[model samples]
Target: MTRGLTPSVHAIWQAMGLVPPPGPLGARHDFTIEDTDLILRLAPDGQAATLEGTLGALTPDPHEATAQLRKLLRLGLGLAGFNRAALVLPDVNGADAAGAAALMALADRRPDQPPLRVTAQARIAPGDPRAAVAALEDILQWRSFARDVIPASAEPATAAAHPASPATPPDSGADFVIFQP
Candidate 1:
């Protein structure tokens, strides 16, 4: 099992007022996403959130595990009114880059709300889930910075420039792998 790299995720879930019922030590975080009941068991650098339904959907593609993690977290936060949230992905030698980009593209789908943000930052250890989770702080900062930098009523210039793009960059960092706009 990976280290408890997803403690931040757990905290985020708690912030949204959704938490799993108490259980034995390391109680799994119970929640639903995309109509899927997930039981999140913390690992060393990540959490193992197994799909808890029919055998047809028991496990996600191993290669897409990171993607699945991102999706579940984003969906929950979005429902909790953190729709404009940013995802800070670690540049793990391109390990999770594609997944992060996919998330960014997905983030722009909700034109009604602000675009999703994704940044590939440095100083955070690569191949460590904590790196990605740690970046959450920067993401929250970006949200606040975005509010002040961009006019609340107006969409970002990039979003305006491309009205049909699903990937929008609400904010970006120099080392970040920006997506959408």
Candidate 2:
């Protein structure tokens, strides 16, 4: 709960009970939680950091992809009360792009392989190591919910074949009512 002072990524890692990677400033470190891959990049000044991870791949169907993207956008905007993490669409070149543009790029590049990956990012503020840990949890929660929204495979039959299966509820644990369309 400290404020006003910048903390090094090493300090944050220690606060989270993690071993700090041996690296200089602006280095990137990778970590995995429950099979989900996450990357943390320390700022040049070592005062701030950005934690990013892929939530899931977008469905190949354009219509479904668009819908999924819109839902993520809404969630990233804090409409679902999840504001700690920001969802983004990164192009194959690793440049940040809008959801629609990224989808189009993915379609042009490799329709067979889902190139459009929805990523979640959270900025670790200076002096708040706990916030960094919270950000990681938030991103992981978003990943779980996003996987349910965006199918892992492009085949529609896969979803149709299991239409009877109930969707996995999000693990937010909050008592907010969820609306289904």
- Which structure among the candidates has the greatest lDDT? 2
lDDT by residue for model 1 over 1-181, one digit each (tens)?
3334244344445555678234333434444433222333443344432212100110122223334445544543553453323334334356666544444444443223223323312223423444433334344443333332322232222432435644545564335466896
C-alpha TM-score for every candidate = 0.24, 0.60
| Candidates' C-alpha lDDT | 0.36, 0.64
Clashes of each: 10, 0
In model 1, the runs with Cα more than 4 Å from the true position are: 20-137, 147-181
Residue 127, candidate 1: Cα error in Å is 16
Q: How close to the true structure is residue 38 of candidate 2, measured as C-alpha lDDT?
A: 84
Q: Tally clashing residue pairs in candidate 1.
A: 10
Pairs that clash in candidate 1: 1-44, 2-43, 2-44, 2-45, 3-43, 3-44, 3-45, 120-176, 167-180, 168-181
Compared with the true structure, what per-residue lDDT tens digits does model 2 show for residues 27-53? 566777764678877655666777887
